[model samples]
Target: MSLVVSSINLKIYFMKTFLAITALVSFQLAAGQKTIELKDFNSLSVGSDTKITMVKSSQNKLVINSSDDDDLSIVNEGGFLKLNGGEDLEITLYYKDGLESISADADAEVWGKDEIKAKELSITASADAKIELVLNVKKLNTTISSDAMVTLTGKAENHNAVVSSDADFKGEDLLTENTNILLSSDGTAAISVKGIVDANVSNDALLKVYGNPKKVNEITSTDGHIKIVR
Candidate 1:
């Protein structure tokens, strides 16, 4: 009887230990599967049949499709975009027939090492869109082609900042600090610099500066003229 009782107690202890280990492993897996969501900083993952519209209060990173039916707009705020931060953010913005609008409040920065093909990209702000900060990076090689106006209220810097349509760029200070600014278009684009203007332009565009001793480093154009008024 003593031997049988001792064997039964050992089996019970083994079973209890096995159950505890299993529970711990299950809990760990569950914790690893959890996701994080914030109020001001949000991330939206779109499905094949849905469109995403975002209005950010602070800074955000967005991933969208260049060939989808969704439309994006940045009205009063600004944000940033990492196309391939970890994985590819493929939210396609279809032509006028797909997603209606994806707009932000302030400046919007887009970082994509590939090509960015769009019908139209519009940014309207009380300030300027800081595109030069992300342009000097060799990891980001992007091409922007739009039919609508590409407007900037601040300054821009990059290896290539091309606008194929009419551009309205107004800024108080244009800081190309250590980078270059390139503006080009088949149509006529006008740029007005309130303070210092440091950029290089193609011949087809025009630039007008209004300030005290505007520092325009280099102005190159195949057919455009730069008029400076102090």
Candidate 2:
């Protein structure tokens, strides 16, 4: 009888300790976050060496973690949220409605934490920038140029990619229904297509195809290579 009573007391003690730790963690997380007041924005323009996590929220909001005290220049002009003037920054961007476009140049890193649902989304990364995102979009347009790289991991009904000047589109996990690609000037694309692929490769460009598409309409010469992934 005494042994069973001791066991019951121990279980109750552990449960109380667990609850206290959980509450402390929740409080710390809330303390480290603060909201930014920027509204009525439909697009994003990032131009800093920062990392951002985008969240889909019921209210259109922007947040940045207060642990890092990097100076940031944020503005909302003409339906676009532009972020700049920081070296080491961490931010959280929230939007209720669909985002139209995102452009990153020279130095920026941004990603979506949730599956971005949109009608049409355009991404432009150039001049040694890097962007990674997931999309549940109808029409997705991408232009990777001038040694930039864009990595995608999601689904798009129609995806059009134009890679040029040693740029790369790393989309092996981004399954597309129909993919149209224009690879030029030693650019590279690693994509997954389920329905059909239309490719125009030239001048030492390379297209790596995955997902075993139903049809591949290729217009290329010996100067370019279209390799199938098994």
- Candidate that scores best on lDDT: 2
TM-score of 2: 0.81
Following a full C-alpha superposition, what root-mean-square deviation does model 2 have from the true structure?
Answer: 4.1
Off by over 4 Å in 1: 1-144, 154-160, 165-179, 187-196
Off by over 4 Å in 2: 1-33, 67-70
Per-model TM-score, in order, reads 0.33, 0.81
Q: For residues 1-230, what per-residue lDDT tens digits would candidate 1 score against the true structure? A: 99999999999999999999999988876554422222221112222222233332223333343323123332222222212122223332211111112222123332122222223322221111222111112211122333333333333332233444344343324323232345566333344433344656674766554444336676767876566655
Once model 2 is optimally superposed onto the true structure by TM-score, how far is the C-alpha of residue 45 displaced, in angstroms?
1.0
Candidate 2 clashing pairs, residues 3+ apart or interchain: none
Report the poorest 10 consecutive residues by lDDT, candidate 1.
Answer: 125-134
